[model samples]
Target: MPETGRREPGAPANVPAARPADDPRPSAPPELDYNGRRHRRAMDDATLWDMARRIPTALAQTARLAWSVDRRMTATILVCQVLSGLGTAVMLTAVSRALPHLTASDARTGLTQAWPALTVAVAAMATGSGMWILADWATRRLNPKIASAADLTLVDLHMKAELSAYDTEGFTDRSQAAEIGAMRAVDLADDAKTLTGGFVQLVSAATVLTSLHPLLLGVLVLSVLPRGLGGVIAARIDYRVHDRTISARNVRGMMRWWLTTSELADELRANTMRPYLQSWYRAMCDRVEGRELEGARPYLLVTLLAASLSGLFTLGMWVSLAALAVSGAMSTAIAGTAIVASQTAGRALNSIVRYGAVMFHHGLYLSDYHTFIGEVRSSATARGTTRAPAPRRIRLCGAGFTYPGRDEPALHPVTLTLERGEIVALVGENGAGKSTLIRMITGLTVPTAGSVRWDDTDLATADAESAWRHVGLVPQKNGHWPLRVRENITLGQPREHGDEGVWDAAGRVGMTEALERLPDGLDTLLARSVWGGHELSGGQWQRLACARAMYREPAVLVLDEPTSEMDARGEHLIFRELRAMARDRITVVVTHRLDNVRMADRVIVLDQGRVREQGTFDDLVATEGSLLGELYALAQDR
Candidate 1:
């Protein structure tokens, strides 16, 4: 069945119809067709059409969010910003009107006219200065709003996206860049607002120019006509190209960021990977810039020539007005006014073109944000499906699976059922699908050829959130978050975790002693560069991971080699706590350490993707040549 109406390539020509949320099974009756052909309903024209229709609404929503987020401080700042724009507009008109008057006033019009023109210049400067002050104020007010809006988007991405999205290259890579790039939030909004204001100026300027002399206004409109069209055309093309390149740019950007900063730090130190990362980043920039240049170059070139032509036409219009003055058809003052009006009209058009270009091109990023939001709405999965009649039992029925981009199956036709409220240990050597099985059990991946069921309900249609909320996952290599140690331990929950809960969870995982030793107790920052911060060893962080999971007290606890980094004593303490908590919950432990393999009600030994043996720990060791016994002997290095 198609998910989210996306038409995936290499999918079956006939795809199964999507079942209703209530109906777990396909609705087709027997004898409907021999071919068993199904129509795949994925991303269709209707979806895109709907997007087009709602784009205005989306933009309005974003604008509102942007305003509200920063409005607290923005209100204070915007006054100055608006004043700056208004001041600039006034200064421009005043300067244009006075410049010609002063040039002509020297001999013919004399000192009488020169005095008024000089006064006009002073007034223009004063207004411009005032507007500049307002611009500063606006910047201060608007930046916070931009930051706030970006923060809101980030929060949604963190909470609304599935845990798997953080791992996937598409969602993670794009989302991270968007979040970081969003630091320009206020600037982006200001640019948008400036463009809007520019449009208003263009309208007012045109109206004023028309009043000055109708002939000059007509000439201005006709002369700059091509430039206006060219700008709109160029901007639209630039934006189109920009929209198409988002995923590509995002991938390359993330790869470069990772290589230069976080993931490949060790590798870069060892080799010349800095050069490589920089090279990749350079190539990505070229690709992004190349697309825009290629699309808009012609239009821009044409616009440049059109602007020059508009300037020539303005000169021609001024000459005609000068000729009229000489012929006594108009006064010298009227002729001077025509020249200013012509210049103002031309300048307004120039501003329009530039503003149009930026808005059209940069709006593509907004569309990326838009598309992401749309995808979120239809993210309903069978694994996240809920039911009224279903019981709460986790079952993996004939489950088989494979990771993305892998040829071979991770778990091949492997089936197992972990009954409710039973602690089971999944013992396996490296590459034995232990992690893969746990991921499937936890609804991270759908089974390739089987179904995971909660009670009698198919897990595909089961409420995955409810299933996961009751589930706790502790992985071996979970890293320490660069927050306070307490914050790291409390990420397992949704909200403001308490000091008591933090200590309680730490006590379960034997991290309370470490917390007590810190200067600020649980509040001490854990990252090295952060103020009053302290760092911990790998073993301690692993224990913290366990503590984080225990904080949740989930019904299904999955510990994937959770104690691999911890010492033998540390492992023993954690197991002891688990044994105490195993009374009414399902605790599934995935571990290679035979020492931590103690006391599960049953230990299922997996080998070659099959459960070779599952019984009490004693029974597994009793099997003379069993995998568990061999692993135990290897641990002792016997």
Candidate 2:
């Protein structure tokens, strides 16, 4: 009810860290700047080399994830890849043998001599192709399962995170990073598959080259080493740039959203906000592009140099093979096989380098996801597991609360009791802690000092789920669920209620007639985005929120400015129903509407996070100089 996100109501100086919000881990040491730009973590030459070195480990971790999802598919891919590599080697050997045989004899004899070798070569190619296809098929089947497992991990962490964790701005950044990281986990898997295939092909080519001539092996290594290293360095540069620009991207997105969202569209157009927004967007885009270019500049030159060096090495290797054939150190057929093998090896090595870089980039993001999940577990607010039974009364004794990193308290130490069948009204000015008090009653927040107890059980040590089961809240800003009319009211509560129960709750809020006018009644979708869906007015949506609370039938009900958008008739009807509803449950209402306070059994006035006065509405109204009397008089004057 108190704007559930981490908002510092009275304090403006408490800034949360900029690191991923959900990552509870300590921040890494300061990053080293490169090319006059700051990055999330420094990517100096040494660090880049270190990250490149870790690619193999990262790829292995990704494979483990894939193996976990489908062991059978993983095994199949492994077997097929090994067989494919062997088949490639055998095909190369058969080609070498057949070529020599075809050229060594008379025409008729040459055909007879080459036939057996050619048949062997064709068979090996067919087997290798079949194995390659099988491996690809298995990898595709395994990818979605790996992604699903990662998604489930993220969802579990999201649901378990404590409300207090959101008090910091870092939580949002970290949560977004984690969400993106979840998808990266799937990329990591794809990278693993690519690495596996590439490694096999590289090994096959290398083996054939070594068997043909030892000198060719040295040429293969020289050709690939520079390019592979350059690719890894390039990946690190791109990742650092992307990570540094996350905040800029967030700013740009928010600026775009301001112009695009339906809530702001009309006002923005009326106020001529386009030019201002465009200027801000341009600034963010400049910042993003500058950082990207700075990171990429160092790699572009290295990449071009590597490409040139690779071309030179490739030419030299081919020349060496031609020389060997011309000098009779190697047969023409063997030299030809070596040439083909060298080209195959080069492509395979390139793939290995490319996929390794991809794995390293995605692996870092995946690590963030894993860390965030751990943080969610450790920072969860509900530490108690003892289930509390439904209570006749709840008491706050010397309870106070101050948001983390804030000097000023949101709520001052105060004592209060809410008993069944009592309707209490909390009246206050803006930031008077009315909503904070309501949240305290609902167990959404725990006090910094003293305790809030349900009957005799301290809420901090009670099962949060059980406490929630007996409470219902209609927040200041109700959610607009993209669901059917029936599902919207019954979102949180179990499906104990059928259509009749839904209508009964709606009837109590005087919303049944409005619902009945719908094309599909309870079945109508509430979202404007859905085809054939019906949209409700603000007051109508407020009534539906109230209906949801009524349907819950909880022991405690907390309503924060529930009729802020309702018409006079609608507000009167709701307050009347609330009075009747409170006859069997404890109702705590925070409102600016003085007329609604008239129905309360008692009224409590709050000023600056402290209780200023308390009495029946009539008594407070009669008591001059009291906060409640002043507010009531002011409302009447207005």
Candidate 3:
């Protein structure tokens, strides 16, 4: 059965006759299709309502923020704006008084009467300009302080937040968006000032217009409506584009970093990947730009229509004023003043609308910052008043942890004890919950189902910061700080550690020689982008990270795949030093290598988030059908 046989034979090409009512084909609503083509959905009612409500709230919030940042300066700026607005009213009144005299039939007589009014107008202009200068000075001082305060607030929140916050989905996106919010917090202040100035001007102009005639006040309101609506609508379009494209922006930013960063410079050149990277980057940029253009085109068309409407209404206002003058309902002086006042009023109204829109848009982003701060605070580890004691016998009583929004736990309930003066090795394949268990032991996170204790006290009752103080961790991908070698090695420790202490820690990881070879020794900067800065090889950087952990000299040490990037000699040196140091502290090493476990007092094997086996390395090797034996065999085969 050919597909066309189901349709009418006489039907025109690319067109279909009406289908039978019983046909199974699903059809889209014809109303949604414009000119037989589907169109994008308009802004929903909820979103439009949010915009309408947000403007006033955002403006008030921004004013409060600015006042908090600089109370004296904020008051001064507002006072000056009020005086300037009053001066504007006085100047308009003087112009009105002088106009009729200047246009009188007798020229000399007109000049005699108009001169004094003109003088007052000039004086008023001078006062307004002077007040504006003062206001500008205060604004300059206020904005930077607002930005600095907002920046520090965000950083402080991030510093206090727990590690679990970083692991959650959309956390990075929210954090990045929050950074933009911090910056916009400063702009919000500027918008606040502009709105204040515009409002005062509008009021002053309205007062003058009402004295001329009550109907002119109505004319002023009508003149601003079209442009005011257009401004708000445009701002909404921009915000919508920004909200929808956050993920795309993140991808584009990451691609740009990958293409230009010095970290990938070698790989890019070695593999000749520039062309492929460039093409990928171009594709991402095109997608982002396409979305922006799609929004922009429709907004431009709508705004153009709004602008035409505004222009027509403005023309109508002028024509009405001219009619009033010719019919003798108004004098030449009043008509002239009305013309000038109406333009000023329209400008003031437009400024209010535009500034309000900007503040509202920025507030939308600032809300992300506020939400992120609240979330981080809520997720922070519960701080205990009691300081943690030095670790002696750490025990996990059926401890387990499941990540947020997950059904299965990352680590299952398993009772275990780790004592001082012993070295332990955690061996497992990837995703076997090795790192999760390590974090639990260190008090980075509390177990979801059970308790972890240090001697007699539960870890949840111990101060997390104090507990962390007694622990040192060497992560798999350790940070390479763009700081002096001495600063990098002794990062968390007091700066009072002399050169000798640094040398001892570096020597244990075979980093002393590497540091000594540098032009400035321990003082040489580690960043490649700066002048006189040096870059280290991956293995060398790994060694430095190990030295940093050793310098901390904590009661509990956790090294997670610490030697994964190290060369054979470096790995051997670290293991030997760790074995020697294990006699004094509780040491736990997580690794896949069979060679490293041999040095441990005990080896723990994990399978599917459960402790599959536990024993001395030699005992594990002797057991048949053992998971450790299988993993050892696999490593050897590789």
Top-TM-score structure, candidate number: 3
Clashing pairs in 2: 21-170, 21-171, 21-174
Model 3, 443-499: lDDT tens digits are: 888888899998887888877888888898998889989999999999989856698
TM-score-based ranking: 3, 2, 1
lDDT winner between candidates 2 and 3 = 3
Q: By TM-score, is 2 or 3 better?
A: 3
Model 2 residue runs over 4 Å out of place are 1-48, 96-99, 102-120, 229-265, 268-305, 331-333, 530-532
Per-residue CA lDDT of candidate 2, range 198-242, in tens?
A: 889889988887887787788788777777777766666676777
Which pairs clash in model 3? none
What TM-score does prediction 1 earn?
A: 0.65
- List RMSD in Å for every model shown: 13.5, 8.9, 7.7
For candidate 3, what is the TM-score? 0.86
Model 3 misplaced stretches (Cα beyond 4 Å) = 1-50, 106-112, 230-253, 266-308, 530-532
